[model samples]
Target: MEEVIENKFIAIKSHINGAPIEFDFEVKTETISLSAKSKEVIVKNLYVSIDPYQLHRMKSCSSSQTTIYLAAPVQPGQSIDTYGVGRVVASGRPDFAKDDLVVGLLAWGEYTVVEEGRLLNKLDPMGLPLPYHVGPLGFSGLTAYAGFFEICKPKKGENVFVSAASGSVGSLVGQYAKLFGCHVVGCAGSQKKVDLLKEKLGFDDAFNYKDETDLNSALKRYFPNGIDIYFDNVGGEMLEAAVANMNKFGRVALCGVISEYTGGGKRPALEMLDVVYKRITIQGFLAADHTKNYGDFISTITDHLRTGKMQALCDISHGLESIPSAFVGLFRGDNIGKKIVQIAHE
Candidate 1:
């Protein structure tokens, strides 16, 4: 017999132009079947990732909406699909079964009925916590791996810089840089985060960006020999400063511009003359586009995480109801690592 269930999901109240409040989100309920149709799997979401890029979709801000299907504008009243960990409640697919753990593009809801099991894959926890699969072991780790290694093409003994060093991607980038024999420095918003970067994450040095009056001077102080590689998460003045301090033939992997996400920061006037004269290379990269590297990324990171050679940094909130607050907290720089919302118990 098929069981019917009430699924509570978060939806936007309206298109938000700037910072989002809890009122901007409303929990909506819908009834769903526990039984799945052909090629479909019904999943109960356990944990979901909270990211800044979703804000761009909510604002209809990302130009990628026209090109990249993932950045399509999220309309009011639509349940958001995000990277998450879930358990199959029912399955009509040959590959999945009831109680099998899975991960991929689940929803910000209690229950998700993945038609055709699209973008979904069976997960092997590798004896690690499930939330680990959501953050450093998932998209965030992949993003850091792809951007730093593939886009930047790092070499050993390089002087690497990571902005938002305590963040999901940046933290991992710093760790990876260190493991790869690079001298890495990072910037964070608080002294606590700075401490975490330097003491715990193996960063060669770290500083509170909030304490620096001039980022250019700060970069010069940290990288007296000039920066060889930069993994940029916070764009704006930091990008400008990095450009000014980059070594000749330096590489920058522009992973994100979180500073400008909410339309709050000043537009950066990047000095093209510096870029040209320094013969530097800057490239923007997305993890999904670099899927070919996933096998190596997963194997390498899983080994490090299991051996304690790499840290799986995560900040998780409980309950589906906390989703809105968790999402809003990203902009406030409240989370020290990957912000995740746990919807249900495993």
Candidate 2:
């Protein structure tokens, strides 16, 4: 017998400009008609990631139009776009069954209906923590791995710098550089994050960027020999400073610019002539473009995380209702690590 469900949903009421988002809660009716379709799975969402990259997409841009060709845009009255982990409650696919766990793109809702191509491989929570799929083993870890090793091409004993150093990707990039035998330095907004970077994450040294108005002076003081590689997470005045202090032949991996996501702002004037004079290379990357290498990224990070060689920090909000607040927190610098919303208690 097929079941008809009246599902409660939390949707984005409208685009927001500040620290909190507007949401519309509604009930929608869905039937089991999807079961007739092959390779279809219906799941109950458990956790959703609150990431900075989503903010970049919220703004109006030509690139945004191209990126979400397959997905629906967030209309004035709609659910926000979010990636989450869910457990299959019903499956019409041979590969999945009742109670199967998977991680992939989903809306900020209690339940979702996914057809072929949207579903990801099943995950074993025993191999990794469930939320890690939202953090390390998922997007954050892969972003750090691909950005640091693939883009920056870090060398042993090189001097490495990471901005936003205590967040998900920045923290991993710093530690990954340390693991590669590099002299790693990092910058954070708070003393607590700075302390965590230095003492817990194995950063060689760290400082609070909030306290330093002159980023150039700060970089010069920290890297007296100049930075060999810069894993940039915040692209603004700090990026300008890092560029000014880059060593000859330095490499930079542009990961994310959380600082400029909220307001369409201009970065401080960069000395591009310096790039030519020093022969510096700066490259920007989206993690999805490097998905083919994700298996390698997962294996390596899983080992590190399992062995306690690497650590992931998170600022988790309690419910699906809190998704808006969690997303907004990223812009306010209120979250200490990866911002995640727990849709339902495990």
Q: How high is the CA lDDT of each candidate model?
A: 0.92, 0.79
Estimate candidate 1's alpha-carbon lDDT, on a 0 to 1 scale: 0.92
TM-score of 1: 0.98
Task: Give the number of the best model, judged by TM-score.
Answer: 1
Clash numbers, per candidate: 0, 0
Kindly report which residue stretches of model 1 are placed more than 4 angstroms away from their true locations once superposed. Answer: none
Q: Per-residue lDDT for 176-196 in model 1, tens only?
A: 999999999999999999999
- Per-candidate TM-scores read 0.98, 0.92
* 1-346: candidate 2 lDDT, tens digit per residue: 6556644456545454543444423333333443525778887788888887665445434255466442334554455556778888878789988888888876677777787887466878866668888988777888899999899998899999999998888988998999989999999988989999988998999999989979999999999999999999999898899999999999989988767666654575789998999999999987777888888998898888889998888778887667766766677677887888888766
RMSD of 2: 2.4
Candidate that scores best on lDDT = 1
